[model samples]
Target chain A: LAKTTQPISMDSYEGQEVNITCSHNNIATNDYITWYQQFPSQGPRFIIQGYKTKVTNEVASLFIPADRKSSTLSLPRVSLSDTAVYYCLVVENDMRFGAGTRLTVKP
Target chain B: GAGVSQSPSNKVTEKGKDVELRCDPISGHTALYWYRQSLGQGLEFLIYFQGNSAPDKSGLPSDRFSAERTGGSVSTLTIQRTQQEDSAVYLCASSLTPRGGPSYEQYFGPGTRLTVT
Candidate 1:
């Protein structure tokens, strides 16, 4: 399992774009980068996933470099309800969670 | 027509007693997983079950914590002689399959909050 490192917390104003980056220096070739959002007292929800380059969805966008050592999750036009803990995981069937980035969207 | 479901959304038990947490996965999902989440903490993998075969119990914290999946659908996580440290949210997730093919997302249940006093 690849260990992930991300900021403990980030603050952004409403309507602003937010980007959370995760570093996984030991990422394997077979690993896939996945991002999940979790709110208080709720389960984590899958936001987006990508293997390389850029993958965009209605919710968020994932940017993976060619080295695959790190990835970034971009949330466009953030709202107050978008405040939550964002987790970046390098997955390969084995599940391991790092301390996720707590994103706080201010109004 | 349904997502994963867990019963007894909350449980408060006394130390040295036993407790059982249940999880009902989505129909036809062949892979199930159990994880523990402490207050303000990340998920801790407990076990994984695929189909009717034996589960991968390597993530179990101790011998006191055990889980079983029946008929490849529902699962029960049992904690014997529970300790105060067992207080946390027990979450259950299910995926389409665990093999190395194209992977589907893992859907999670609301989880059962266990408090051992």
Candidate 2:
């Protein structure tokens, strides 16, 4: 499993774009980058996943660089309800979770 | 469609007692997993079951912790002689599996909060 590092917390205003970066220096060739959103007292929910380049979905977009050493999760036009803890995980077959970045979208 | 479901959302047991937690996965999902999460800690893998084969119990913390999945649809995680450290949120997830193919993304259920006194 690849270890990931991310900020503990980030604050952004409503309607603004937010980007959370995760560093996985030991990422393997077959590993995929996955981001999940977690609210208090609830299990984490999958937001986006990507192996390379950029993958966009209705909820969020995952940007993986050419090196694959890092990836970014971008949320556009955030609202107050979007405030939640974001987890970045790198996995091949088994799953591992990090402390995650707590994104606070304030109005 | 129904999502994953777990029973006994909250449990409070005294020390030296045993407790059982149950999970019912979504329809058509063949892979199930159990994980524990403590306050301020990351999710810790406990065990995994794929179809009717033997489970991967490598992540079980201690001998007192054990889980069983019957008929590949429902699972029960048992904790014998519970201790204070066993108090945490126990989560269950399930994913689709194909022969020789990778397991699909896991769908999680609301966890059961266990408090061992």
> Which structure among the candidates has the greatest TM-score?
1
Question: Over 4 Å off in model 1, which ranges?
Answer: B99-103
Those runs of model 2 whose alpha carbons end farther than 4 Å from true positions after fitting are B98-103
Which lDDT tens digits does candidate 2 get at residues A24-103?
99998878788888888888888988888999999999899999999999999999999988989887556677688998
In candidate 2, position A58 carries an lDDT of 100
Query: Each prediction's Cα RMSD?
Result: 1.3, 1.9
- lDDT tens digits, residue span B60-110, model 2: 999999999988789999999999999999999888863122234778899
TM-score of chain B of each: 0.95, 0.94
Q: In model 1, how large is the Cα lDDT of residue A46?
A: 83
Prediction 2 global C-alpha lDDT: 0.88
The DockQ for candidate 1, computed on C-alphas, is: 0.56
- The local lDDT score (0 to 100) that residue B84 gets in candidate 1 is 98
* Alpha-carbon lDDT of model 1: 0.89
lDDT of 1 by residue, B84-106 (tens): 99999999999886733334577
Task: Report the poorest 10 consecutive residues by lDDT, candidate 1 chain A.
Answer: A90-99
